[model samples]
Target: MGQPSQKPPSQKPPLQPWGRLLRFGGEESEPPVLLRRRELTIGRRRGCDLSFPGNKLISGDHCKIIVDEKSGQVSLEDTSTNGTVINKLKVVKKQTCPLQTGDVIYFVFRKNEPEHNVAYLYESLSEEHGLAQDSFEANKENMFHVTKDTSGAGQGDEPQFLPPLPTTQVCFEEPQPSTSTSDLFPRVATSSMEPPAGRAPPSSPDGEPNPNLHLLVTDQGGDTLSAPEGVRAVVEKPDRMEEQLTCCICQDLLYDCVSLQPCMHTFCAACYSGWMERSSLCPTCRCLVERICKNHILNNLVEAYLLQHPDKRRSEEDVQSMAARNKITQDMLQPKVRRSFSDEEDSLEDLLDLSDEDSESSDVSQPYIVCRQCPEYRRQVGQLFHYSGPGSEQRAMQAPGDTPSTSASVTPAQDYVCTLQGSHVICTCCFQPMPDRRAEREQDSRIAPQQCTVCLQPFCHLYWGCTRTGCLGCLAPFCELNLGDRCLDGVLNNNNYESDILKNYLATRGLTWKNVLADSLAALQRGVFLLTDYTVTGSTVLCYCCGLRSFRELTYQYRQNIPASELPVAVTSRPDCYWGRNCRTQVKAHHAMKFNHICEQTRFKN
Candidate 1:
């Protein structure tokens, strides 16, 4: 319920008249409503203009015009009078509504029937009742309104307060009242340039009607207020702000942080310089770096967040948080952005294949998670290592070769911890406590694996059989049960054969040898490079035969070095052996074993 908007007239007046327009909301055809002397109580409803005067209903007091612009009903309540009646019913204002054409209302001032004065400007409704309308108005027709100068104005001529109605409403054709805002404060309805209901506003014949046209109002006294068109706009106050990223260097803010040319990656002035020093390209886009800018929207968000939390200490964590927050902001502004998934998830097929391969080996060759919750890294290669070189002496001390393993001899770098097992790794060599398996695990009680006596490092057995041998000197982990021939029980751990050379030579002349057991026997074989004074490859040949596995390394030595072309070829039953010079008798090629004894003691002699 509001009055129609008014446009400024071209005819000038030095000053506008003081007046307030009455707005009608109820229907006009129906007779105006009335009030009775009944609903009033002891306490008056504060802040309301209509109040009961000691058990009496009062109307036409401060109310002037009674008209209806809309079809709604209008009424009032007497909050103090107790004798008031609405249609012969004694109801409080809380119960009875205002008067209507068909409904009868009664009011009495002490002892008489209250008179209904539908007067427009009676003493009870105008300035005489201490009720005066204002004349102040802001000609909103002109977006930019300029008021008249107050200087040289005559006394008693100036209006007290002007109705600051946004007068620009007349420029638009659509009619709408500020119902929402009206409840809050007295509001002046504004017209919209939108087409009028049922029909559009009449346009000029030449089209583009009233271009450069503006609304201006002038009073008879030469006072003027003109509105500049299209100047007034809805100003939006910031509702909320989001942060995105931060500076890598100072961690303070990115100054002149221009978004990268290609990728739109934002960075500060000093940061880009530092980054360019190492590589000439944008940190984000990887584009060739030619120039940079200082003002970047992304970086601005970061700076703003850090600025708000002044007491917060900046750190890698803070930087990361800032980056995540800023990313959300950026994504909000620009959706359709791509994001990367976890490496494991992305290469799921490869990981599954690796798992299958490891399953065959009982997870021995499988990889373990060093720390499953390792913070996400924004850069590639999520880890760093200390290599052997200058400025790496600290790492050398930590992992010294001369020292034993971390558990016993050597140490490891702080950056790395063993991850062979959930929290422990087993060594295949010396079947002892291994450091490699002492990695973190999901389990509370971590079980570490033991070391192997063979490799000294942790291992998951790929081959079957017991490889835990006694000859650790050769780093073999197998017993006589696993190996076919030659029992290495004595020579592997501590030789327990004869202490003398000659005695050990004749000890086991020829029985099927699988394992050795005598410390005296090992002692007897000491320094006796040759088992017998038999004809050799012109002298003697040494064979370093590996007992743990089926492998052997044969080395042929001669007093004189001769080229292969000078040697004579000979045909023989064996294909792996060749003839040597001097001592004939073929000697079964370069070297062959002739099991013979000092006397007739050996039965399998040749």
Candidate 2:
């Protein structure tokens, strides 16, 4: 009995088709055709759903729009080399971004060449509602259908249905006679005349005819109405006080009116203040007003007028407040003095002198060695490597050596210090100090031992390979970790390999590195460095023979001449520089061997 009355199966709802109405030209231009497909492919290729052939800006498969029938959601995926921007924000390549109604999309050809780019306005539509379809079809007659010519030039031909031009006709109407007395005296009574019910007879106070009413209305005889004998009708000039009250600059009823001195021309306080920045002259007559002041009488008049027309007061106040905020921001952004090397040196020297005096005054005299690695030296117990010496002056004067003396009471140096002594090994990749052989050997047994050819310093290699690979062109040793899979041999074998590698590397860090590399390359080409023969490798700028160096070393080598302040600091910070002029001779020999050049002309001059 219960199974006898089973309900009929419920019917599923129809899937609503979603589409986009892509507008190409300006907003005032004719509407675009409504694309009703589930997926719309847009590109310059002939196979694309919407193709723009011969347009270098559009890639073969520029982008696609996908409409989800179930969710009624629309998304756009960019697939072009130039990139697609939505609402001024760049859409991620190969990633779908949700699109809303009235979203603006731009196909950027070249970032700097925005003029050549194309823009489109996106409008989402649903098949459930026929309004969008009807409107699109209505305007379809006016829209152009583009077709490629057999000769290969892409251009749109005129539509099939052309509307006929409308003809213009001329007609003239006969003049009509005037009926009202106010029409007879048009100029006098046009603005001030009252309604017929409000109109009253001219009042004769003290048995005297009103002169004002005589001027307003006149009979067919051209005489004043009910006037005293010999009293002629004189039209008093229309009150032009409102015209005088308007600001010359803003051309509106003045707010906080201020008058220029000598010229006495009135303007809105905010407008005049903004104008004074460019010119101190009156905008109307161009008269100089160096000593400008607010006209309080005119300001009162303007305030009275503003009270009657209360709409403009808020806007004027807002303008003044915005200007004040802008001024404050400008003041905040004023350029500040940057610290220079001389200032840093002076401060550092003062600090060192103070520390020396403190050590002389203290009961327990501690021996400190002036670090030859870094510029600034502050006397802290464990901050510097100190050794027992006869005096502080002698300790500072002692020759810079790598050997750790037995008499030396070694202390850990600052992180930036690179004296190349004790357990400090400079990393071949970053040119920064890493754990030395002792530290690496103590920490992990699996750590493979390696040495940098440039610095001749031993280090542990965990990633990539243990031994450094020499550049095939320059014969310079470079760490595999830093150089990635790139090598000079690969670059020489294939010309595009280096460019492809650089492009991939630049993509990882974003495109900003290209400009940095360009600037460094320019500097190198200009012979800014003592060692001119160098090349840009990824983010690092390396000397052709000596490999990578710290930024400080590069700066020192670029200058060629040492500054007095930097003399106390390490003169020979890099291993090549530490080896003296002989290092250049050896580098030339290696360059000659790798490049197959004669060493006679290429020998180190200095």
Candidate 3:
């Protein structure tokens, strides 16, 4: 073949620098991703090249990007639940749309989810006839050098040298005039020159120095010339003395001043008292207030100052009046006492008697009263009573020593009644009837009633184990068996210990109880009585002979091959006809004959 007559060498086309740079996470987020590949897949799935795990609205296979290398064109196709948006417009699903430089892409149309949106900054390789790539590489190198130089420049006390950054021409829009005088100067340009040594630059009419450089010359005597009289110096005035003494809560002059302990921060007694009910921290320093006491000295001083300044007295009176009204409203909303008993006729007498006793005594005279709800009693007399309801004469006639029983005829006026008659109080946890305190006191004089730290309700330790057990985290008395044991001790209603134990056992083995429970409940909900325990040991094994043989012959083979663990522990199918056949009896007979195991139908309990 004449050594293959020398053919002309073909020149390879120059590799195009065209690629899409995806800028995601907005301005305050992470850096963008530079896509060098011709194809890009975006979705929540791990297989996708660009995954958006933070976007729960996105589907598993959301969208795809295809780049045409020859044409330098890029396109995106949406295959997601919410679909995608291009340049603020929704893109059709499964349809490719060409994307250009500066095109914005949103995974979803939801304006609330800004994190899923991205912008594109395209760099066309063909720009400047292939000179774009060379310029980009040079600019990137310059940026790297600038970054490295600036990072190490600010370390020493002496200023380090930095290469001057390349300058570019900036265009400004036409300025519009406004009422403000500052708006007149809108085109001030910056200069590289510095002012002369030792002399300060001249300031503008606003008294602020001009940010731009200005040249100034000083005389031989070194005396500086003052700026033109048009520029006036601004002076700030001191705040009025009364402004410093204003209470933060009422925003007025302090009255009945009370100082919070530890910090000694003062506030109006009524304002601080109401605030202390919600939080025990000082309003100023946020320090814990162990206690708050009336600042008599400060109170007298403020009083004297107000007396000297009569104009402020009216404002002080208005604030004090408002505080008083707020205190009254709060008192009305919160119950003075948490009634122990529910609405019932038999408990009406005891509730009325307690209310009567409370009304008879002054709140200040009584120490803290331990009630079902409130731990303290400091409200006005009779505030806790609800006496509008009809009284029960039968309950009133009954002796105090008699044990009260729930009566159908008796009805209570209020929702809560004092169930405790004389000394008989109900258990806060279990609601179990406790022995009379009079009887208990006679039996053991030294023993006293214990109280729950959380509810602050008194419960007898002798009746319900002990109320002293408290949680370390909150220091609150949480019933040990109920909270600590997850209520697995059958203390709560409908508690199933067996089910709980099984769930705990599966959880310990790395199996989720929710999955197992969901699967089991689904079958039960479908009315499927078959009890199938799919253990870790895959599927049940079947004999080859049984597979080929008839149903009658299969029974004998099933007996020989079935495992003990695979056998159903219980059946839930009805004994009556099911699908025109007795499913319960059939399953029972089949299990009994095949595995020699007894089958008992059981009811499913939640």
Candidate 4:
């Protein structure tokens, strides 16, 4: 009877679909299309699985969306003439790229008239993906908001599309008309070289009018801008500051910014980490990436920018993806020893017992070397090493067959003298004795004593500072660290490579290294160059090459600000180079000597 009443098997719930595409920012919004099939074709023609008849640019078979069964990874294959854009990145025709959740797909991009553009907001339907279809549907009304361009380009006539970013957009309405620009904007300026109104133009210390100053005066009507008397309107177009805040690798705003050392160029930590897996060279400058450190300053600036432009902030799913890929950590910020101190430091009683056991087991004495510069040295009985000399201050070899006692000795008749001869390391820069950190190095290379990154030679400045036992004055000067610029060309002159232009310029100006330092100091004092908190005028936390780079940059800025009257007449009279510092012609001594490379490029693509 129990077998006859057995319950029927319960039906299983339907499996969640993998992907969906929601049409956005056109003449009208449409319901999202589920990507249920393994491969689906999209086009303008009726034969295609996903057809958009309104889009004239789409071909009969424009692109194919593919979903991997096992991995749940979705990818897009573009086959259209107009091309497909995934999150602002144009996909090469016939190539496939894996699509991430919240990626925007554009069949054809029309910068103006976004309403005419064929666009789709890609969403992964999985709840674990953090972009469930219901969440997108719930916020559908406030999804795509087109606003006026804030870059002050084209008189703010063109509308800016915000849907492609896949982020939360807090709508910012137009500010009410106000007399004060500050009321309307945190910073407001025309896309011109003319300095903003109300701020005094920078002048030289001698009270001479700055030749570089191009102040524009607006009429009372405020409809037109005009240059002052004898001041030519430079009419330099403004650069898009927004581009500077984005990572070149991801083509998105930076997150967890990390700077590539030697180059000092910053990028998103997760983006750069992915790049590093393929190659160790910096993507922007092509410089060899030596070390990476968090760019705290740039991170702060990025946070500030995101606060102002909330729409540019990445979605939670994108943030989680990037966090998983991030390789840089706080541990990379500082050097650490290989082993924990707790493991290295045992009880004194235990150490004494071990020493006694060692003494009883062996007749030969173990040798230990101490730094001569150390403050105190004592030869304890049954110790690993012993010092023998007639004078307490002088160091010599111990007499043969002089066995050390196993027991502790009485108080010394005179003050104990520190010996220089036993088991000490020599400072790479000063050739002076210092404590050996070999034990720490043996445990972990990252925690090893400070050394020159280029030559791999140990320095005592950091080692002595850490120990807090040696005199600071005994350490070598910071300059011995060989501080240089990003390229490290002029300062680190080798027979293999040298900057001829730098050499000739120094010679022409009758400037020595001392003069360069003086000018850099003067630049700092005059606010021509600013230093971070970690960096002092004479001391810096940066490595030798980086420190030198700071000085080199400051020196260049100082030289650029100097009036023509102060410079050589021939140099001032030389025609300005069109390509500026980026000129390939500068490699030739004749071209470098003929034109100034410190100024901005006058000739650019229109």
Candidate 5:
């Protein structure tokens, strides 16, 4: 079996004529697999050129290493469940990736542990590089333990691994005429790399190999046209790009494409937005969608493809339906700043300034109107007031004797009309209709409606000049409010573990809510500021008591800033808590009395 037979030179070119795989890892001593043809399949299949019979991960027909004879370009097309990896990059199943020199191939690269799974180092071979048949025959017996003679030439009963000639002298054998005996082994009988029985090889209409056949799908009987050199540039056919461009959700051409993050799977923006209404996971990968962003690059490619095939363009009705379904936007990925109540006031002033500038300046008698969104029942242009300064005569306007909130102002009119009339949202507080401007100002915190941290529901708290009845404050109270007890009562009252921590801390002190309030008031009177005095902004979604405990823990930070002379004598003399604010023992009554909790940690031993 190891003896080299006196065979004539092959007439047809080899599948891959420029590269050979050097065995490594599991079989470092084995002979190199010679790539001698334009395409060589490697797997467990006996008919495969490079068969791995023992490896379970390697599929029957795992993958093919294809080489372009004229261009000398090498590529690996993956076709296995375990998949193939070249140069650390996993080749997508059924997709091709160009191979490069020094690329390492892995059959199954385990993430956690290294295994003896077969690995190969790709070496690009030149015309000068050749392995003599004698050197390869030395290791033939061990390498052909599983490989058998599929050709059935009746030369020997013992199986032998018949590899193609070395890269430097590679050749493809022409297909022999069919015979009755050869028909018995339909797949393995022929050594020639020809198309399967009855299936003609894919080629251009001019009887030449299609240069862009890889881009044009052949499984669906795609038409192959050969354009004359100057007639048209050979771009990928639109049909070939259909599968890549089509939206997985809608099963149509992608319109306003968007990509889900983490997974990086793409779909139509409207399709995904609608899908998110029911589930936040990606439709393709089932992974949680952390963020969504416009796939501008894919959108551009889709647009180019649609330009070539206008029929693939979605109709106006379908486009509108998609637009209506779209809820998520690129703004969701934007960095959101937790806005304070003052930020809204600044935006309101800016809007007022703009409105004043737009009014006619010629007539001094004509009063300049500010809020057009407000109803006629509300304050008129002449009645509007501006808050200049303490010295200025202007003062905040007083509500009408009837209280405008009680009037029809809170209710939407039967014939109300505006640019965004259909998109108006009723304010939860005022019960008044306010135009939803989130779509227009989503990227800007100053203009967008502030959302509650706990509920994540957008509230009509900003000054839109249309209504002033809503809670015009940072309803998503922060640590500052929690520390000062300014947060609305009962809003976040809940029985939870975080709340229990606070309850235990207070109970151990034998102090009621009134006692704590009085102490905080006394501290304010003595000019002993808490953490909120230095930092006025921050948001939280924690339950009421938990928020208080978080603020209480932060109180030590402000106390540390005070000079010993400025600090209270009790706190100045009290020993600092070993774990400081992060003290797990703070919840224990004995530890709370032993050490001062209003100071930074003295030891970081833990």
Candidate 6:
């Protein structure tokens, strides 16, 4: 009975291979194509419903773009009195004008009453009015200084100085690339200097205006763009914008973006996480990579550009108008039908409204030390190390057991004020500025009170303690009940090689003796130490083939300049900097030529 239904091993099943396979995710997964080449935006923009409510500037067919398939043209329509513009070109009412690549379409909207500044879709090019007239490459960040009205209330709108940044480009158009076989990508301007010097003017063959700002004409097939000399067309060139400022991941115009580094390619915020999930390497440049670490500059840059895009501003207006209109409609329908809030609901709302946390002011104190080693080692801490003292630099120069805490000769307590200490955490203690209480608060503030490094969860340190590697090296809190001070390092078991285990554990966790000693008591709690070997090991290996190093590595090595016999052979003979692939080969060949037994037998073939 069990074998009755079984088919013979040689019998083939009936085949029906007629249905089509819709391939999605797998090895053939869309072939990792650029999002643009697929002719699509990562996400569709949601168009607002027609007709909005109170204080509404424009709604219900407010802005429209009609695409004509026959003519390959796009026509713009704006009900707002100001105008509808694609790029900066004002669209004539019914004209079906041909659209070019990278065109920035914008609409201007001003509310009926004199309320918020006219909610325009796109800002103008005038650097004066923040119009989009500046070169995209040029620094266009504007600065303003605001002053308080001091009427004993709070912050005021009155400004002391409305200072502006160096006026530059609001937008830039990348000229049509040459037809020749030379590299198509725009070459980054070369410089003679790498360190922080100043950018100098480039020498032009024509000896004319700055090429960066000049109106260089481009030949599109036989047709040439014939705008007035120095009159750059802002409206007609979204293609150029697409080329220069597109998100590397989405291939869309960068809305809010962030640049991935060591490879400085920028990608839209939505796309970056996915791209980084695959690999953090910049998609445009095929270079080695690191993780998506902090990038303040790129974050700030994208934030600024997104502030200018008008599409989002207009959408927000639609939602607000609808809400207002609905409120009015409800009031008109039920003038006398007010619903009382439930007692339980009111109680719940009150609890939710209460503040769990506020933007509590913190005293950020900084202390500085001289030795380059400690400060350089403390890049994870950043600017604080520059301004704050008590680093590897300070520790080395200190007298034997010279405590920073004891050094502070305290005066009697005066008017109570908050002070940020030299350590990293914002002062939880008070409202006034925290002083570098180095002598007083050195050891106690090393780490956050009871946070565990593994779980990042806080525990009572009294019960918890270092268990695996022993309490000597692993000061991490764990309980003797949960974990006895069992020594993986044998420090508790008293192994002869316990120091080796302790060193390895500390190196892996970036918690060396020097780091612990230098940290302010507060820093230890928050965990603000560099998670890397502070000691410049035989220098860094930038290019393994050539044995090269980085500026930081050399800086660390030359800093001490230990005698050759004492230092490792690698640190002694390492190449100063990264040699390009070609240069590295040439240099290697030259050196090998001097020590070739094979070359001695066979005359040089190269």
Local distance difference test values of all predictions, in order: 0.28, 0.40, 0.38, 0.49, 0.46, 0.29
In model 4, which runs have C-alpha deviations exceeding 4 angstroms? 1-389, 392-458, 461-511, 531-536, 541-543, 603-606
Tell me the tens digit of each residue's lDDT in model 1 across 410-498. 12223333333444343344342223432332252233222233233443221111134442222222222123334333321121221
TM-score of each: 0.16, 0.20, 0.23, 0.25, 0.25, 0.20
lDDT of 2: 0.40
Residue-level lDDT of model 3, residues 195-239, one tens digit each, is: 233332233455332222111111112122333322222222322
lDDT winner: 4
lDDT by residue for model 2 over 270-351, one digit each (tens)? 6665655544345666444534566779868767766885643434444555356332121011111123324424454344
Q: What clash pairs does model 5 have?
A: 12-172, 13-172, 14-37, 14-38, 15-37, 15-38, 15-39, 16-37, 16-38
RMSD of each predicted structure: 32.5, 33.9, 33.1, 27.2, 24.1, 31.4
Better of 2 and 4 by lDDT: 4
Off by over 4 Å in 6: 1-43, 48-245, 253-256, 312-606
- Residue 478 of candidate 5: its Cα lDDT? 49
Worst 10 residues of 5 by lDDT: 214-223
Candidate 5 lands at a TM-score of 0.25
> Which regions of candidate 1 are displaced past 4 Å?
1-423, 426-481, 485-525, 529-606
lDDT, candidate 6, equals 0.29
Error of 3 at 378 (Å): 10
- Candidate 6, residues 1-606: lDDT per residue as tens digits? 000011122256533221111212223442221111101111112332212232222222334433333322233333232233343333322222223324444332112222321222222222232222233213211212222333334323222211121221112224322111112112122111111223332323443221121111122121222223233222332333325554433323444455544575655544554443443234566443342344456546545555775443324553353344332211011111123435534443344321211224233222222221133433434553455565744444332212212213212122222222233221211111222333342375532233323323322221122122222311122111122222222221122222233445456666643332233222323443222333312222111111111122221222223245544353345442222111223234333222211111233225
Global Cα lDDT for candidate 1: 0.28
Candidate 4 per-residue lDDT over residues 375-463, each given as its tens digit:
44333321324343335323222221011111112111122244454345555545655555556566865442445443455555544
